[model samples]
Target: MAKVQVLGTGCAKCGYLLKNAQVAANERQAGDVVEKLDDMLQVHEFNPSALPALAIDGKVVTVGTLPSPSEIRQLIEQSQEVEE
Candidate 1:
């Protein structure tokens, strides 16, 4: 399973991104692998210049803006591939 992490400050966009990430993961059958990080300390660990960053397997994949569900799905798929 891929480890999908959403890093944000618990704002609207952050929440949306987390939901989108969840939906994307579910679409890819990775729903149970998604995690959200709203704590400033943990979120800053990713060093995102913007809110709502998406990290897969501890590596930041998207940052600064919200990505579409399909886009996020693709990212998750790619991460899975890399894992294999």
Candidate 2:
């Protein structure tokens, strides 16, 4: 299964992003595990100052904004393609 990580400080925006990401993954039928990281140190480790970052399979895919359902689906597809 793919591993998805959302990095943020547990703010509203962060929560929204995480929810959106989860929706996207489900829509795409992606068999991935989604996790939320609210620690600053973890967010920093992702090398993004922005509050809401999306990572798929250990690679950062998005930051600073909540992706739409279509966008999230695209990301999931791309990640799956890369894995194959």
Best by lDDT: 1
**Model 1 Cα shift for residue 11 (angstroms):** 0.5
How far residue 28's Cα lies from its native spot in candidate 1, in Å, is 1.1
- C-alpha lDDT score of every prediction, in listed order: 0.86, 0.82
Residues 1-84 of candidate 1 have per-residue lDDT tens digits of 788899987889988998888888888874448888999999988898777898988999988889988998898888888878
Q: Determine the backbone clash count of candidate 1.
A: 0
lDDT of candidate 2 over 16-61, digit per residue (tens): 8888878877876747678899888777888875768898888889
Each candidate structure's TM-score, on Cα atoms with residue i matched to residue i, is 0.90, 0.87
Where is the poorest 10-residue window by lDDT in model 2? 24-33
Give, for candidate 1, the lowest lDDT window spanning 10 residues: 25-34
